[model samples]
Target chain A: MAEKIKILYVDDEPGNLIGFKASFRVDYHVLTAVNIPQAINYLDNNPDIKIIFCDQRMPGKTGVDFFEEIRISHPLPVRILLTAYTDVESIIEAINRGNIFRYVKKPWAEADILSSIDEANKFYTANSMLMVKNEELQKAYAELTKFAYSVSHDIRGPLSGMLGAINLAGEIDDIEEIKEMLFLMGKSLTKLDTYILSMHDYYSLQRGELKITNIDFNKIIDDLKAMYMVISKSNKIVFTTTVDQGEVFRSDEVPLRLILNNLLSNAFKYQDKKSTNKSVEVSIEVHKNQAIIYVKDTGIGILGNHIGEIFDLFYRANFQEAGSGFGLYNVKSAILKLGGNIEVNSVLHKGTTFKIIIPSI
Target chain B: MDKEFSFIIIDDSELDCFVIQKVIERAFKNLDIISFQNANNALEAIKEQGVKTKPTIILLDIQMPLMNGFQFIEEFEKFSPQIQDCYTVIILSILSATRAPADIHTEFNKRIVGSIIEKPFTIEKLLSLLKNMGLADEKIVLSGKKLLP
Candidate 1:
């Protein structure tokens, strides 16, 4: 045995208790309680006691009554009944009410009692494991339900919009009017596509395991710039990146890319279109063990009250524009899985900045 | 339809609002129409208009961000009985796959909602609903056909 399995025996006869303890003390930690109050006290003090074998015919309270009493206060410990008589009626009643694990006939055989103890210990471990796994399954099922609801809501919202716009497009005869409607339809289609991609990101973040590898910061920055080149040029926004790194950092490459991609996209998405000077700056500073990145933008910043809940799923601070609201949530989830931290600072209508610190290991 | 009465749409989706607006335009002539994308703003407008606005029908969307269709009804119920009596609410929902719970349907129906219209809304459905409510009376051009009995 790896360790002694703790057990308690409650009986009225002193000799019986002594004989049971003498036989079983070698294989397990055997504790004896002469009465109901003593057993209750032992149970209160040593909650780790895995099994209890109680004598049925005790003074004042029967073993069934004692088991019923402790079942509520200390429910985890498995209970067994020991009686000299073969009373099927009382045994059936005890099993039905208290969910007694086993019924032992006394004068019990030494081998039978040892075997009962071993079986009870195995049952206790299995029951506890089942309870733990049941809780985990319930949690995972709830999250799946929430994810399904979100997908339906996000997808259907834009689809209805696009369908309405298309219906309107067919009715109009003027070329310019139809063109404007098409532009709006295009926006709706883009929103739907963005939502689909965000859903993809969410599933991958939840299901994919982290792959640790050497990350080249310069190469990642160059790729991001190339990706957002058209967006920056059209919006008249000055996009810049500065990297201060001496050696290659170590982290999950995919998650790092996801985090940066989301933050940079948000920075560009929420930029103040009417502002004369629009800029998004990304700065990365790497030390021997950590990398700190800053994504700063001159944009429509988040409200003070909403900043705390910005990372929440399906949370859109600005309702005028189209967003899946999963961007920041996915970014935060990735950061947590990477053993990293992110913080945001913003001034409404002026600017916003995100600071992230990721450990390189 | 009575010229004194008008149509009001309170929906967060701009596209849905635009579609409803176009449908109303084609259904009737010289009828006043008001629409809002924000529920709070719509509530404020209704409150400011008060008893001045004539008997109106509201098309309320259920899935707004902050203040949903149910919340709007709760707030609208707080208005004076005379002001509340001037409006009949109808729910507009895009989620046809799942219906609202029976309890919610019962609760909203008790207060204001007359019916629910699933998207994408058609001209016939809107006109039939209006006709049932004793609003649309005249023979009108819809989809280049005369709307008849």
Candidate 2:
């Protein structure tokens, strides 16, 4: 409507083609093509042409066939078909192939033809706007992820130095109180370390290209237990497993470890502060083409409303509790990457459980 | 952990270079200290040092006028093996947080320069660092007073 709307008109009848060229040719650059090949050639020659009009009743190839083939080879113009009521089947087929934006009846009025072109132009503009908005959104998301990654790296480096100094504080003998202080420092470091590690995994999940591997679920559990042996001993946490004994699954090992580590750490971190009885139970079960790992903790359980967004990035269920807010986010992302899913179940002041399901294959 | 070595710090900023100099001094008491207000004169004095029998560690300040720490490292790197061996350049600055010692380690390796130590160094921090720098001493004697027996 602004200026110089271009269109390609295809028909077998020379008279009808002339008629189309005569009507509304003043405001438009109208190209006439007698066959499918000529129409394709015109489209290639004039790229600025914004709309396409094809006539269904042709000698050799019908408009529907031409439109279907146009999809693969050509970046189509907004397509409209001029066909008789008898060619309804062909018109319907064209629509199904996503070839035609609309259909016009034969012996079309000049004003009707002009309006159709106007409608297609508006539709084209709206589609372009949607595409631009999508691109901008993607760019914004990428920048936010980059900022999170940098913050994680900066925070971790200093945290490392802090932990190193704290660990070295044990050598001085006169400062007997420093021993108790080191215990507190170690606990805080563990809390800080957990938060930082969760952040690290979250950043990696958002920005990383994962390295996947085949793993035996039972073996992974055993290794995890070995890794946390010291912590389990100090806390007097009795860990129990209900795995199906010998089961193997294939997925990315790195994220899988992250998911399990976070779950296991949380099971330890949020234990009932008052209750002397402390323990954790983990189980692995398989359903056709998918494997489920259940991490059940006898700890400070989650609230009902907060259960909805447990996996939201940096979303903390318990503000007072020591958490980095990235654990569940990483768990969700890793599971998604493996073409799997995760869910949570909890009862306030009772217990919390995470069901992590990865594709068994 | 790294090999223990003698070191010196040259800076007009007493509070600025205080902790770092003490670190080198206590960790390796064998280290000699050289304090300077300007790097240009330091460069001139270093160039005249002709030759030395043993390595004399040099911790160069980066913010000094006429020539900064990097420029000094560039010039010090060009000196004869006797002088270069004695010269180890540490770009002591407070602003460059992300600039790590690894950059100097990679470029200089065992030659061109030493390492970077972000400024406002503390005794507690430096002592821990020196321990890792291959000082066999089990305890880092606190700076200001003699270690309690």
Give the top-scoring candidate (TM-score): 1
User: lDDT per residue, candidate 2, A1-361, as tens digits?
Assistant: 4768888999999998898898868888899998888998988888777888988879988787787788776654788888876555665687887478988888898777888999998887787788789898897688677546544433442344344344334434447545545554455466566666666676688678767566777778889889778878888888887667344456778878888888897898788878788888888876565678899988889878888878776666663325555777778888898778888899887789988878854
- Note the residue pairs that clash in candidate 1: none
Task: Give the TM-scores of the predictions, in the order they appear.
Answer: 0.76, 0.43
lDDT of 1 by residue, B4-117 (tens): 568899887776777778767665656788899888998998899888557788988877776778889999999998888888887887765255345446667455777777
Strongest candidate by DockQ: 1
Weakest 10 consecutive residues of candidate 1 chain B by summed lDDT: B140-149
The segments of candidate 2 whose C-alpha lies over 4 angstroms from its true place after superposition are A1-196, A210-212, A245-248, A319-321, B1-149
What is the alpha-carbon lDDT for the whole of candidate 2?
0.67
- Candidate chain B TM-scores, in order: 0.84, 0.62
What local lDDT does model 2 show for residue A68? 79
Per-residue lDDT of model 1, residues A1-361, tens digit only: 4789999999999998999899999988999999999999999999899999999999899999999999889998999999887777997888987679988898899878888888998999999999999998997798777667666666787787777667666666679866766776677678889888998898899889889999999999999999999999999999999999987789999989999999999899899889989999999999978999999999999889989989988777775647777889999999998999999999999999999999997
lDDT of 2 by residue, B88-149 (tens): 55555443437543453455444544445554444554455444543325643343124312
Question: Which parts of model 1 have CA positions greater than 4 angstroms off?
Answer: A1-66, A81-90, A104-114, A144-150, A215-251, A267-317, A332-361, B1-4, B96-100, B109-111, B139-149
Could you tell me the TM-score of chain A in candidate 2? 0.56
- Tell me the native contact fraction for each prediction: 0.34, 0.00
